[model samples]
Target chain A: MTALGHVPGPVGAAPPAPEASRRGLSGYLLMLPGTLWLAFFFIVPTVTLVASSLYDPSGTFAEGYQMTWHWQNYTDAWSEYASTFLRSFLYAGATTVACVLLGFPLAYAIAFKAGRWRSLMLVAVIAPFFTSFLVRTLSWKLLLSDNGFIVGLAQALPFVGEDFRLLATPAAVITGLTYNFLPFMVLPLYASLEKVDPRLIEAAGDLYASPFTALRKVTIPLAMPGLVAGTLLTFIPAAGDFINAELLGNPRTRMIGNDINDLFKSSVIPTAAALSVTLMAAIIVMVLFYVRKAGTEELV
Target chain B: MTAVASRGVRGWLGNHAVLIFGLLVLLYMFTPIFVVVLMSFNDPVGRLGYDFAGFTLYNWKNICEPYQLCESVGNSIKIALLATGLATVLGSLMAYAMVRHYFRGRGTANLMIFLPMASPEIVLGSSLLALFVNANLAGQLGFWTVFVSHVMFCLSFIVITVKARLSGLDPRLEQAAADLYANEWQTFGRVTLPLMMPGIVSAALLSFSLSFDDFIITNLNSGQMITFPMFVWGSAQKGIPMQINVVGTIMFLLALGMVLGGLLLRRIRERPTA
Candidate 1:
């Protein structure tokens, strides 16, 4: 929080001279546009969100003119959104687990076995991201079609009877989340694993340590920071995202995103605001929990 | 000797186990996207998919047939470009100021700028909606509202990218330029500009992509303006048209091509330079 006096103070090696004053003025001028944009949009809007939530139920301004403060807005929305939040949490959590279970191995391979192709593999992980998320998701819809080739394949499975429906299901939403966020998990894990010293593992072996013990003690602990960061990165977006849930999930399995969305569309501003605040708070709490459990500095 | 050899075998299995698991993750990550790319070719006519329909360009043709796709695409391109440009310039200046100059409420400013990034897109859309309604601004919804919102969203990304680059840059470069008779403008133009170009370009590109792909904010803000995503949303409600799959496939392929091209260029350049 550089809310304190943040100024360029004796930054350059140049002997403290007449130029210092000029440089500071120019710098301040340079910063003005961004400062204006932030204050006008970010700060003002945040203030608006809080004030809007407090507006009485009759409307904040003239009756129905604006959101009137009603503390109950939060409580009312909570019951509606509680299951939604739980569903979102479950989807997000499942995605995180899926990424770790799926991503760690690929990361390990790239870091160790696929040495020369590591860059190419890394690029592949990031490649899908370059394209439109909407497009990629739409493709999932196509592939998961009842008569689509993927389903056709599923039907071909032994003893599997009836049409296979992949799209419009909770599993589809989870799959989409995992598809989108796997890269977040893999990249960080790769970064950490790549730096792991092989000699240390050898040293452990020389001390008669079992292979399981070596990995459990050395690799897991050392990679804990990346794992934590990756989990946070995946979990936050998965929980907050409305895209996957919208595209892949049916109405029966609405997540918190759907709840917020309904509120927004219906012009239920205060309740929507409360839900949003809760969502943001949840993320902050998760981050803090991880930090406390693993220590802030070590957990990335 | 036997013990050592057994230890070697155990290490191999341990490493291989991780590798197998990693491959599984990569496969899962890829499968859905891969499926999308593959299905983009299938001609969808409601309950029909990939029947050896013998690949048709009809979907791409359909883009301009019944909808204002060209208009939406053009609008998307224009709005994204303008938003990217605006966000880049303002964000870079702010980054320079925060990183290079003294400013009061710097922490407050940083938090303020980053706030939009943390809040959900819907909140921003709603807040802007309220702001405009209260202000009695013309056009409750349209391209302008969308553009402004895009700019607001892109600003955070640009600021983050530029600030990071600014933080890492050596202040000495600017000082030296100034000492040698360069004015503030000249120093920034010649010295600071070149170093920040990579970051600035990346930030711009990222914002452009974001603006182009945006759905939630656009859906909320647009009154009648139909962007590519709006078109997709409407079509999706009726079950996605094959045109979407075709368009999506093309976009994904294009992205892949650019990435491969970039990699090839890097390889060739590095070979010569090294």
Candidate 2:
């Protein structure tokens, strides 16, 4: 991801160069505190989680659990929560597609068509997110309530029954997920799209290609890095998010996150740990496969 | 004449199509925010469902009327500030090492920094809870545990942000300071730190927001403690207080004010030079 690289400075200017000489002892020393923090708080926790997954189911956290190498925990958690896992991916995947459809146009517009309003548009994209997350989702609950204006409108549509409602539906959950993560999709897409040379599109237009053809042939390929980055950013968090599902979905629509949260809350530590590890592994494998399939090895 | 007029209209629409579409998307994003703002002023006729009743300023004036709402908000602010301070310091150093110094296992360090951001929040929270419980620190899951988790997550973001800023910086400026007979400490304090201030400040702001808005991670680790999100989640199950919307509105306004103030300050500073 470009998060690791230097974001190029103002257009047409060279980015700053890194120091060419190798740094010695001081470099590792400088990294010591942060690396230790990550090791203890981040890496160690992940290791502990994997270990906890193998703990015997009979033990509790209060009484102390034992590491029994309980492989069945994985199998049991997987088989029972398979639907939840599938639903998480499905919702996340749909949210990613929706974000791209909605965000690509917005990013493209800001990059090319916004003119003097570019910064204003960018601020607008981020401003809504600065408010409380739970508060915003709660507002959605209000907006989609059975007697709310949106549902009333939906009821008026053809083939929609009078009993229809938006709240506690998969549609509401997906909408919440999409709304919350749209900025993630937009920012990277804007970063890449803004860097695209305008002349290439103009050249395509001059060569008898229509605007659509120019966009498809010239622009889409150039924005591949951003598309991949935005999709992953949107999808990964969307999959892991339980707040929307909990706030907006009914019991039947529970994702893996909800299951994990409930299990952890109810003191089902081993199962929760196993499920958490499985979800993480699944995401990592999917990401690696995606990066491979997209042939964008520059992503790290 | 009619055909030419139609063609002209088509051309105009073509030119502005994406722009129009984008505005719509932005509108969609802000609709819920509008609801939140509107609901803050709402006078609920009923105890529960979130219909916008008559407008009133009662909720705004009595923001802390709800039980533990203000307390939870105070806790969140305290935790966010502490987490931001710690994460920014550690992260800035790590970013400096990654960008300015070529070291062994540099690639591994970079991977470590990126992995937390890549992992989902549920996994992060559960894994951290697992760690705490395994270490026999389950009983100690409160502000400190939440603080630890916040810093862990915020570090990756801060490092990524500061690394980008540092990588975009020209090393020659510091070299020039050295050539002018300045000591290393003097150069760092006067030249490098001043130049890096914007990045550090923005990274701090980002970390604060992330820490403040976090729910799932905090909820899992925060045993018997209530942050603002936890408060909201609890209230959601019961009847929600209009005061929650008041808090949300105030937060939005505060953040907006900070952003605008920063922009204004930058413009004022640039004016004399320009």
Candidate 3:
């Protein structure tokens, strides 16, 4: 075939500059499969969920529920699960703050301080995640149990009492959330931090700024995009997470996700759907507000 | 002079403080993993209790001794592989289109791709379940439903990963290929596709892991299907089987091996090429 003949060419031939092809039909054609997949599976399902949330509260699936445009379902759901919603946000906020505190240093060390070991440290950061998440959370259960070494260590600490238990408390839930989502925070921080010029920090040092001042003024501003991204990533999922609460916390620490999950299980589909939609809307609003306040427009 | 020396020492300690704190954080992250690995070896005296007793290899030796654990693992692998393949293919094409072409609705397309990642897992899972229930397909929720959800979630991640790699690529190489009188197909097959391999590979790996590790979404839509995560959840309520740790350890080692192996292979390839 003549087509095959064109494969081998003169190796050193200086080819002409590549001409920009017209914005043709192939691009749209190429996008068709994936876009259709997302549209059907993601977009359609989301619409269906919203519709289901408006179904009559009194009607079961077997009884053929009608969509009466019930906005009251949201109100009912909210009144029933408002505390759970507030608790989810609280836990998520705490987790996000904790992740920032823990992940920033680790990400900074990997980006700037690890030097030749940077790649290895990066790998190490993600290596633990290869284990199943449930398993990891379960191990946390073991580690935080009353007689575990972690509890013993905490008991030995100056502020902590001998009677303080870490497991099945809000502290345990928040700890699990922080641990599980820390990588999400770290990876983005690393990405943004790696791009910052070392000279800026050096210049700050040369200008007689202390290390803390240099970090705050020079490094933190440059890493804002990553920080915003990291916080959003950490907060959103942490808010929705029932796994940590279910495994690590007592009923007192249950979050909105637990309520949604429980409601769905109990065949309260309309209420569950309403709660899910509310959770998503609340998160989106918070995210939009935070991103605007943080002044990072590139994330979307 | 003493004050000056002490100040200098204090500053140096402050400089290295972040690194020390970082290492401590790393240690904290690995603490539970160590417990899991250690627990895997523990021959617990009772029915899969959390307490560590004398170490033995019995769990490793009889990983499938627990009822349906191996079956669920097999199901997870099957679903993960299927979802990864489907998502990677679909997502890479979408990423390619987004980056390489000046398409209309690009902004909307980007938003669509991003929405799933931004949305909570609970919403996504419940929505899919709701869709199935409304369509009267609720009774049929099983492997196929789980498979579909896995693909949906994994698609967003794949698209993002590959798009990052695609956007960063220098187009000059493809231009050079075209300048050599190569057709679009030849140029793509020879230059563009080869260059995008790393992105595609990483995306596939990400997709596989996401699908494999997903619990919340799978739990909602899976009906009676017991993927590994669902199995773990079910078992956690009853006594957890010690064999789960063996599986966990194996997954960690295998993933670590694959990543390191990929790095090694890339290094080997780049050495001569460079």
Candidate 4:
């Protein structure tokens, strides 16, 4: 489920016709518009962000920033917002783990058990997306409200008090993140699990391997590409997400995204740019490390 | 015989354990959606609009009662339509090029397409803001800026979706069409386009949804204009109108209808003719 995994076979695999390969000019022509759009909006903007990060910190929107190339902006932003950055990753990590746990059984059942209802089940999984994201998150706020049933149920525990609440806590932010991104995990997992040959599992069972053992050994290894893809998809967006934190979390639970947004709004352009660049760089580094460790470099 | 029957019952339960668990997860996923639907009929007595005060048809009947809500919805629809159209056409052409014809720097082109998906929205939004700021377009940031960004991000998804469909096609079908003495344009129009329609349609649907629901990037670029998500965000800070839930419920119903309608159409088409 890497971005290119949808494309069949290896890159530059045999063209359908010899003339297809020779018509490179047409290929380039077809690519030109999209390529130029990406270059202008994606690539150039990214470069501008890096440059903005180096601008003089003292400058304001009114004063206009100068190209001071001040390297300390990185250190300044990092030193000030390190905890927020760490919290974002921690929340995102927890959300990814939660999504995997919740999503796996659903994806598994949809793939192996649903039979004729598979597509319907898949649509059901994505149906939540039809609603507005904010509205759904708002419903979560209702669910986790202090006087809500969920909190009342939580307060019933022996260790919990009547005052126990789910909202305005780190738990709330993480729950919101997990809920929002669960489909990302499930869809990829379903895609890969759907491809797993049923005969392989039957073969394992015939070999006297227990169901759990077969799942751990046979099913999981085959679904690694989707697992890796799903986790990255969940983690990357969760780390950068501010809506969950802003809506569900208290001020103390603020993530890097919240800080970056606040900084940008307050006209601290250089610091905000610095934080944005740092977040992107950190995510890229972690993704590379993860892809390498997962031994699925080819998928990417 | 009693013991054997008991063992068979146990086997049935064991087999269904995963299915039961999966159903519970699905329930959890749909709970909020149910809440949104339920809230559309809520006659809230307070500003928070958190609880179901009383069930009434007022919110649904007067959906446009809230100031600027309908206007924002209109803006979102316009943006979504335009962005989806542009992204689908450009992306399908690019996907066709990538899959049907081999070219230099294909690897680099693929990487360029993939990078935007990998990057977080915060980074993407902030970087674009930075670009506009530096380019002296900060004052001009509004609908067009948001539209450009929407197309920019939607392009990658469209490419991937259409590329998957294009590459999955049987080359022999096109070759057969050519063997029948069909011209290039004729072969493409009659064969390739029809075969690729499902992918293109899906890509367009995906792009429309993404553009319509976008907030993070839109929030950064939308200086004075209010889109639906932006309006929702603004209301979240102040007071939420119950009509917002009405809008949410409508979007949900519309999309679900389209999907189910498409599925029914496909099933009809796929049925063996007597």
Candidate 5:
């Protein structure tokens, strides 16, 4: 996690001295190429996406779309694909919660209990990232297959029936999402928890607090920044992800990403653009609300 | 005496409980990779490589059995290399500027760098596609378009990684170098650059993996070009070939070897100095 270790540090830290006085045009010169690359590719393209979303729905790619200021595109897209949007959010929300439940303990152990094996454990957490993404997702598809061990084991449970299956269900898709993004959640949580002094926990214990109470009152509050960051990182991408649904889920479980990709493929640009913009806007609003509630504005 | 012994046992269990749970979670994380490695040697009877019927080394022997798999892999390697090089250089410069020098609009610049990272891949891909279409380059979308988009996304990650490495440096080293009558270029080249090399290398590695594994953005922009992920995606809709798992296994092994090798080298190097 060394590469990703310092990401959540204070973003607006002051510039170092010794070069502050000599910085005339050299700073701008150094910043020019990269900043211009981002400006042209990232900033301009976002504006294009927004503009394209409002194009008239009747126009074709061959005939060129007209800027009809069609505010109706939003309503039309929402009316048609609202369920997909909701499903995306639902899946993403579920994935985030599952990640927190699973990731917190793993992160906690690595932070405080792993001792000298901490670096090795951290490497293990991120080792999955080296493999190709699609290949790993395909492995999940195999693991959750109807005749696979997982499903067979589930059937052996008294509560589950003999015909029980895990594949092509919301559970499977959520499982895939949780598994794929677990590292994202763990890393940030570990980053923040690693900074917690043992003395603080001991202090809480000496003050007549139980171990659990110390964790609740002291450790968790200190880990809020990481929690906020981890959740956002997990939720935003999971909400926009379609790979799990496409592979591990049935047609009924398609997320907003599936539709966006389909619409784009079918040459329905404005609608796809509308959906993309809507997803971005929805994520932004939720993230803003979340960060505000969590009181970590500097994370952004 | 019995009561005290039982309490000691209970305390030991309590202390190890979280560690055991953490190891289980790590096991869960590696389950898919285990499946992948197992399936790499699988000899499937049907077109779909779902169930492992028998053991065979056929997939490893002929990894290029699937048409266009190797080609797509070559393209991915080429793109990843080029994208990593460009992003690393450009991003290191930007990081150097942001950390070492005072500049106006620093906050705005930081925001600009952060936005691309925070945005979803779908949004970034679609936005890039939208820009291409607006520029009348829709029909011309190919390797270059995908390359540009890869660089665009990889740039922010490189900057962040390098910036983290840059800002953590002990500035007094450079001050010490200057006191030895070293000029700016000499001090930077000899001292600063050497220290920053680890960060830059890690940043390059991060960008390479990001660019290589990128499917969402590349899929949107690549009109007719098929990268490795795109190849797997296409085959996934049909029946995936067993050779794909071989590729997966190789990637995992290569990356693991490199990282562990680096760690070993670092340990060995630090011993003598320490």
Candidate 6:
């Protein structure tokens, strides 16, 4: 509501109100329902549920049951799942790298090389999104099974050891995340790259700068915003995702997502909620940092 | 011009490298999907490696078998359509209100609408599951809970796409219509609606595909009901069934066909006006 008061009232649709109080009245009225829905569904549920994570099996909030905050639950979660966070980070980091490597060239080609076909390429990049991530990822389980094509290829690799099962490995987790988030990376990158003027590249060539040098000094820095956005999009989902781990990885490679989903369905709500809260906090911190760096105006 | 001065074979190769590299990238992007679709038709008597499967539709016929697996596919399509329609209407009104109508607390409202999208599905699915149980609504949680949950996610997508279009529009065009003695309703109907139709269609298509593909939230909410994702998941745990591959292949191709069709139709519509 307070944020709404800052908006320069609705400019076009309805007739303008008195100049003095327009922003306050129109802003507050229009923003009320959306804010209320968030309060009801998001803020309330998250806060209360995270609070309830302190409850022990006796349903008391504290050892003494005096409504004390038992911060030990947070400590306990770390002791129990110390490796899970590292695994989540490792998996997400690998996925981010893979998507960048796989997606950047496609984006570069689309932005610079393709003339009439840019929109069509974008449509193709986004088309796979029509299939659910679950369906698409699960389909990989069949493709990357012990008896699958990749399995044979792995065995054929000269120095590899015997009985390499690609299905239930960390490699599988990375492969799945990379496949799922490729479009997210490409879309934002294209948005940035498409804005780059073609004349600049020609000017660099005319100035006798090598193609490689021009890309390194010019194109990369210009597309930093999209790269940042794409990295966040890939990393955030990869960290939170339980699907890839559950469908593809061995127990050793299961990330925080698998941890949360595993605990939630098994009636271990408190600890699951605690992990979720911690994960949510990490995401919030990252988002705040990116917003500050990118500036509020850059992002919607 | 050093490469230009090398005007024979090497220079030609350098120029073509981008196109070649691009073709390779396109092939890479297209590979996993290609393998899945081709392998879905693997004949028992054909080559051991299904990098090439004999032209066959055996997998498609597997869906006709009298099993719960087939039922799940039907259930998934029905849920996706219902959820998409409901989300689209709610979201469009919200978009219209945000773009066209001035009201209070709009910033907070906007934040609330988009928050569901950024909030991870794990949190959302569990929260909805807990709420359903605590509220004693599991009996009614079958389709209704799933539908509502899908709308919560889909609505933000709809609003974003439509709002993008609305912002593109010149505000004075609508104002000019009003100045010519057209009422607000008539102005919207005759002017705003026709102009924003492309975005509206895109939003609907996006919403439908999203709802169709959702698995996590649907799984948490659907008690005895099974969507295609759950069916594939449960079957994956047992061992990846041949038929599930069939389902996946069909879904992928069907999605590709529909999206390409929609783009083509939009292109046709644009030409007449252009």
Error of 1 at B254 (Å): 3.3
User: What does the i-RMS of model 4 come to?
Assistant: 2.5
Model 1, stretches more than 4 Å misplaced? A1-23, A58-68, A111-113, A149-165, A188-216, A219-225, A288-300, B1-24, B45-52, B102-106, B136-139, B166-186
lDDT tens digits, residue span B1-274, model 3: 9999999999877766777888899998888888888889988988587798888999999999999999999999999999999999999998888778767897788878878988889999999988998988888989999999999999988988887786667777887899999999999899999989999999999899999999999998988989999999999999998999999999988999999998888778889977
Winner on TM-score (4 vs 6): 4
* Candidate 5 local lDDT, A1-300, one digit each (tens): 132222233544544543443478999999999999999999999999999999998988778899998989999999999999999999999999999999999999998888768779988998999899999999999999998999999899999999899999999999999999999999989988987766677789899999899999999999988998899989999999999999999999999999998888788999999999999999888877876765432463
**Docking category for candidate 1?**
acceptable
lDDT per residue for candidate 5 within B37-153, as digits (tens), equals 999999999846579998999889999989999999999999999999998999999998887888898878987887787788999999999899888898999899999999999
Local accuracy of candidate 1 as per-residue lDDT tens digits, A79-161: 86788888889998999999888877777677666755777888778767765677777667666767777778988998787
TM-score for all models, in order of appearance: 0.82, 0.95, 0.94, 0.95, 0.95, 0.85
Better of 1 and 2 by DockQ: 2
Model 2 — TM-score against the truth?
Answer: 0.95
Give chain A TM for each model in order: 0.82, 0.92, 0.89, 0.91, 0.91, 0.85
Worst 10 residues of 6 chain A by lDDT: A1-10
C-alpha lDDT of residue A143 in model 1: 62
Q: Kindly report the docking quality category of candidate 2.
A: medium
The DockQ-derived docking category for candidate 6 is acceptable
Which of candidates 2 and 6 reaches a greater TM-score? 2
Q: Candidate 5, which segments miss by more than 4 Å at Cα?
A: A1-22, A290-300, B1-6
What residue runs in model 2 are displaced by over 4 Å at the alpha carbon? A1-12, A20-22, A290-300, B47-49, B270-274
Candidate 2 per-residue C-alpha lDDT over B132-189 given as tens digits, one digit per residue, 9 for 90 to 100: 9988889999999999999999999998888777777888888899999999889889
Q: For each model in turn, which proportion of the native inter-chain contacts is also found? A: 0.43, 0.83, 0.65, 0.73, 0.69, 0.20
**CA shift at B221, candidate 6, in angstroms?**
2.7
